[model samples]
Target: MTTRFYRRTASVLLAAALAFNCAASFAYAYSAPNESDLDNHQTYRNHDGETVHSPAHSRSGEAPDGATARCRDGTWSFSRHRSGTCSRHGGVAAWR
Candidate 1:
């Protein structure tokens, strides 16, 4: 009986170890690229003349430029060219 129990225990332990190793390998195989892949990226210039570097996996598109105009109520959304940007921000910017 003792020998049979030992055999069963050893077999169960071996099976568990194999299953864990297989699961780990499968997870690693399907994983996405790591941080080193992000080092290879592209840089773009926004309207504010600031350079913006993005990783490979980042969303490929343009984000808003720098400060357009801030309102007295602290409201400044995206507005290009700035023709009528100050009006939307409640008249000329005070630069506060």
Candidate 2:
């Protein structure tokens, strides 16, 4: 009877620990930054100690809005697509 009671007590303690851990994680979520505060992008610093460009959310066949891209032909263009090809130039494109 003693062993059975000890086993039940241990099971209750384990369940309480697991519940507390999950609740703590959920509470911490309240402090996470909003999605609008973070956007998809990439940044690079030029030799002149300046940020050359800060690219933002962009997609293929859309206006580049001043961003630049490199084509497979070793030329530069602006286009962001899954194909990595400039929709305007018909060549594989990559962010410069």
RMSD values, in order shown:
18.9, 16.1
- lDDT per residue as tens, model 2, 4-42: 999999999999999998765521111222224224444
lDDT of each: 0.42, 0.44
List residue ranges in candidate 2 displaced over 4 A.
29-96
List the candidates' TM-scores in order. 0.30, 0.30
lDDT (tens digit, per residue) of candidate 1 on 1-96: 699999999999999999998765521111232333342344444455544332232132222133333444444322333334445335544331
TM-score of candidate 2 versus the correct structure, residues matched by position:
0.30
lDDT of 1 at 43: 49
